[model samples]
Target: MKTMKMIAIPAAVLALAGCATTPGPDELRTNAIAMMKASFKERGQAKLDRIDQDDMQRLCSEYVGEKVMPKEIAQSLEKAQQALIKYPADGKLLGDWKLGERIAQSGVGKQYSDDPKKPAGGNCYACHQLTKEEVSYGTIGPSLYNFAKVRGYGEQIQRYAYGKVYNSQAFSACSSMPRFGHAGILTEEQLRHVVALLMSPDSPVNK
Candidate 1:
């Protein structure tokens, strides 16, 4: 009886140790999310819900430390995102490039202090060299100078620009660019204007 009891005691200890050593993916994800949620409170327009990851966001988060995502996974994510893009009702994809320039320059929305009633800014200049005149710009994204001149002004290019601006993830999975239209950061008209800013030959971007 004593020999049998000793063996069972060690087996029980080993089982307990095994449980303590490994946490599954779901548990780790849940714990991480809970910790993140506890770190911040809702501030005005920025609510706690923003912390919750959608399907694409969660997959992107899973591949964070990797240098490149798996091709199959990336393609799947892009396909899903592409389906979600909402194009303008009218066939017209371009709006006033002048107005588009303003939206691109302004960075005055989506903050706690910013007025909710006012429109959000695309802040395009912050990341891309949109015009030759704007010397100070971020290198995070590629230069957009002579965008239409390089890409060519055409219906297909215009459609690609509009879709990309609406949801960058639709083209590139886990892109740093915001899903402007998908996230409701930009309205349909605002998206059209931004597309014009990139596609219009008369716009400074193309000049």
Candidate 2:
């Protein structure tokens, strides 16, 4: 049953993609805009323009389901993404590890039913094994257990983790991880907390 669901989803997506008949890039975008406008109705804070793509998104979509892009294009994309990361203004890289755990475990907020004023979750556990006790973690990303110990708790690792969480595309051009900080899904405070979870020796991830 689970396997059937997975196949069905891809089939549905392919069907939808086939429905897009526009021949050129500009026309394809126009058709996509029209399709979105016709299929969805604005409700709460979910605007129709939300379906619109950013430059990176458009570039990535152009190669959807195909082989990997050229190395030059991939490097160019990663470089652009790295430039978009925003560190905390206070120069502090770590925060409460406890708070970070909560954010990492949570998968709430950002849905149409969610309150926009409230902070969204990092939902890290959905893609990475964060600790020994988290038996329910997904395997989409590499296990992050002992992240600090294995990588060594240092300035470089701290910066790398923070930047990767901020904009994963900087490290992996086709990473499935969401650009939490880059997309404004989480604030600097929240980002710091999450970073602490992955970097602090005291955090469960390190243990």
Candidate 3:
């Protein structure tokens, strides 16, 4: 009885110490960021600054994993992102679908090893299935096969497609899709090309 009592007392004391010293949310976040910074060494164009989170990104992180942000906050964020969208000045929302297919197929840019001078690819297949011919594709996003056939190849849909590609956060808050235009990942012409890929009837995506 004496030996068991002594062990129990030390175990209880250690439990209390652990509870007292447990880190709070803010402290835990700081510690996690510090750890990430330590391990992510800068290489080529990929700098340590990539670890930095903007206001939107920080809030998204806080609300992830079953703790969805309030609808109001999400809508406000989406509105702010929408305001950042820059439509084409010429009022044209499409380019060559052929070029668009090339951009969508090529995944040759933005990595640490990629040349910054070269144009980046949309890599649409990495997330969304764009055509029925593609036997292998990621299922992370909805299949875009027959995009224009289902949605109708109208000016309105074209504009929406262009804007969504430019800044997906505008349409869907905290979307995983990259802000191709807003982030300068894709040029204005490239944005148009991608729109053509989805909106053009001749494109395999619409076929």
Candidate 4:
């Protein structure tokens, strides 16, 4: 009985295999996207639209595995991203570092459950060491404990800091850092505050 059952299964499998073809990369990609779309239920501000990748994002995805992003492409992408940074017209990049610290510590905002009426958070502590006093912090990115101190508190550095927080991809293509200002995840004032957290001499990050 067992031998007959085993033989029957392979015969059924062979019959099924003969009728079906393997999916290619494009088909597989389409299927995967469809599966992902079906898997996550849309709710609140988080809709199925989040699954849609922008052109730059799709381009970045192409070279994600076992492939190097070309230097020319990377430079061009960085230039394009740099162009997206809109500086405050007043020419002031600094804000209240104290408020900035609060924003960094708060991980609230930008979730399906989060209240969109409230201002979003930078959540910098989730990926950076912003101060020497922190006993715990994330290390996904570099430690920015002495950001301004190490980089120097200058206009150029300040501009770089604001641009970086606004759109990190401006400096590094395919960076995992969120484009707070560029994406409108954080307001312009919030971007300035976060920049102050990194660039202000009075900031604990500099202390």
| Candidate 3 per-residue C-alpha lDDT over 187-206 given as tens digits, one digit per residue, 9 for 90 to 100 | 99998999999999999998
Clash count, one per candidate: 0, 0, 0, 0
Better of 1 and 4 by lDDT: 1
Q: Which lDDT tens digits does candidate 1 get at residues 6-111?
A: 9999999999998886788789989988998999888899888988789899888878664568999999999999999888777889999999999999889998
Which candidate order results from sorting by lDDT in descending order? 1, 3, 2, 4
- Model 3 reaches what TM-score against the true structure? 0.92
Residue runs of model 3 more than 4 Å from their true location after superposition: 1-20
Q: Estimate each model's TM-score.
A: 0.86, 0.84, 0.92, 0.91
Score residue 100 of candidate 4 by CA lDDT: 94
Whichever of 3 and 4 has more TM-score, that candidate is 3
Error of 2 at 125 (Å): 1.2
- Superior by TM-score: candidate 2 or candidate 4: 4
Q: Which parts of model 2 are misplaced by more than 4 Å?
A: 1-29
Better of 1 and 2 by TM-score: 1
Tens-place lDDT per residue, model 4, 25-92, is 77888999999998999888788998998777878888878899999999999999999999999999
Error of 4 at 48 (Å): 1.7
The lDDT of each candidate is 0.91, 0.91, 0.91, 0.90
lDDT of 2 by residue, 1-207 (tens): 999999999999999999987598778778878987899998876777778878888788777665668889989999999999998888799999999999998898777788999999999999999999989989999999999999999999999999999999999887789999988888999999999999999999999
